[model samples]
Target: MYDYVKGQVTRITPEYIALEVQNIGYQLFTPNPYAFRVNEQIQLVYVHMHVREDAHTLYGFTSLEQRELFRKLIQVSGIGPKGALAILASGAPTHVIQAIEMEDEAFLVKFPGVGKKTARQMILDLKGKLGTLMDVVELPSTEDELPLFGMNPYGHELEEAMLALIALGYSEKELAKVKPQLEEDEALTTTDAYMKQALKVLLKMK
Candidate 1:
């Protein structure tokens, strides 16, 4: 029933972000949790409610097209919310649409959890239905709101931000690629700032 949640990101983890909207913190699972920074106020999370026998969860997205594709992905046989999210994490919805259109099962099967059967099912179910998604899906921009540096000698904020990034689905190897740049920048002082900087490096990282 909820359409969106506008709030600050108060917490981040490997699978979810806790967005505090009014007085309540909603746990929202997203494709790229690290794309957001902690405590940056006023973000709109386009949402979908996924209900199961034991619990209900909210899957959040940065844009309408992302949310719509997520919904569509779950409707296909053998594609659950988590599976759909892993596929979306590639940041290449256009490539996925093209693959489906082209019936390139190999490319589609390259995504995590997608196999030959699932790939063909996706093509069979969604060949021409994804044009609107392709036309509208664009990368959401991350705004670096603050710089966190030179505030403390111990670098606690940087440490915490690194842990948070690790929690936000970034591997240690991936963080190692950008850690030196962050270390060299003495301008980062807060976890949010470091998180923002880290996200910039990650989004640019191929």
Candidate 2:
């Protein structure tokens, strides 16, 4: 029922980020947790609460358009929260919209958990429906000004990126294939950078 939360990001893990507001910490599962930087200043995260029989979970996004896309994706058969997160994690909402609009099942199936049938279902269900979101959904920029944190002596950032990819339903085999390349890239200093690079690689592999 909650629409959003505004707070300082206190922790960033593979599965979620901890947002502290007034001494309370809200754990928000996001498409890309690494995208959020731990900061002193408050940031806004639009949220969707998913209620299940066993547990209630909250999914957060950097923008309302992203959240809206998530909502639309989950409405399709076979696309759950986790699957939707994997698609959004690519940080190319416009590309997704274009693929759907163009009925590009090849591009749609590149996302984890989306096979031919699901891709067809998505096109059948939401092709023209996402026209509104196409205009509003913003592409994620690499030039974020926020200062990155959570660095350690060891190669924790790469490990975290791998774990995050696993959480998004990528198999270890897929990650292992790219591990060596990611390790060799000195420019990937932060988890966010590693994640962005890894996703590009994985999408190419598809």
Candidate 3:
């Protein structure tokens, strides 16, 4: 029922970004919340509404192609939203389509949850149908946005970094243990730098 919402990114969680538009907050689930920065410009989240028996949900994508590819992935048997997200997280959609078309079961099985059987099913179900989609599915650009040094000394970037860590599989309890140490450090400008620092702190926390 909705096309897109344009608002400042106020809160970014592991699985969602809360956009503040017109005194209201819309929490959008995206594949990568780090793609957005706090207090950044308004974002246009190309959305897909997913309705199951017990839940009604909205999933957002950075691009139309990502949304379309996500739609196709969920159509395959045994592939749910989480599984499809894990596939996209590898940051390689064309590779996935190519593997499906080529029936390269080994490549498909390499993803987080895909085993031999699921991989084969993907090939059987989606091989030929993905050619048109492949032509349009381009990976999002990977250029670093902001610098790594002397950015948010107040721990804004550090907080965002922790959210990203959770998205990458770290738990809240784990992040909490080391967050104070991270805040004790200097400010970081870019998200990438914060990610690196958080990883280091997490390793030391272990």
| lDDT string, candidate 1, 1-206, tens digits | 98887999998775789999887999999987766778667888999999899999999998787788888889899999999987776434665666776687876776668999999999999988875786743422233211211233225556767888787799999998998788777566345667899999999986
Indicate the worst ten consecutive residues by lDDT in candidate 1.
Answer: 145-154
Score each candidate by Cα lDDT: 0.77, 0.80, 0.71
Quote the lDDT for 82 in model 2: 92
Tally clashing residue pairs in candidate 1. Answer: 7
Candidates' TM-scores?
0.67, 0.69, 0.66
Better of 1 and 2 by TM-score: 2
Q: Considering lDDT, which of the candidate structures 1 and 3 is the better prediction for this target?
A: 1
Candidate 2 regions with alpha-carbon error over 4 angstroms: 137-180, 183-206
- Runs of candidate 1 with Cα error greater than 4 angstroms are 137-206
Clashing pairs in 3: none
Q: Rank by lDDT, highest first.
A: 2, 1, 3
Which ranges of candidate 3 are over 4 A from the true structure? Answer: 137-206
Candidate 3 lDDT:
0.71
Q: Compared to the true structure, candidate 1 yields what TM-score?
A: 0.67
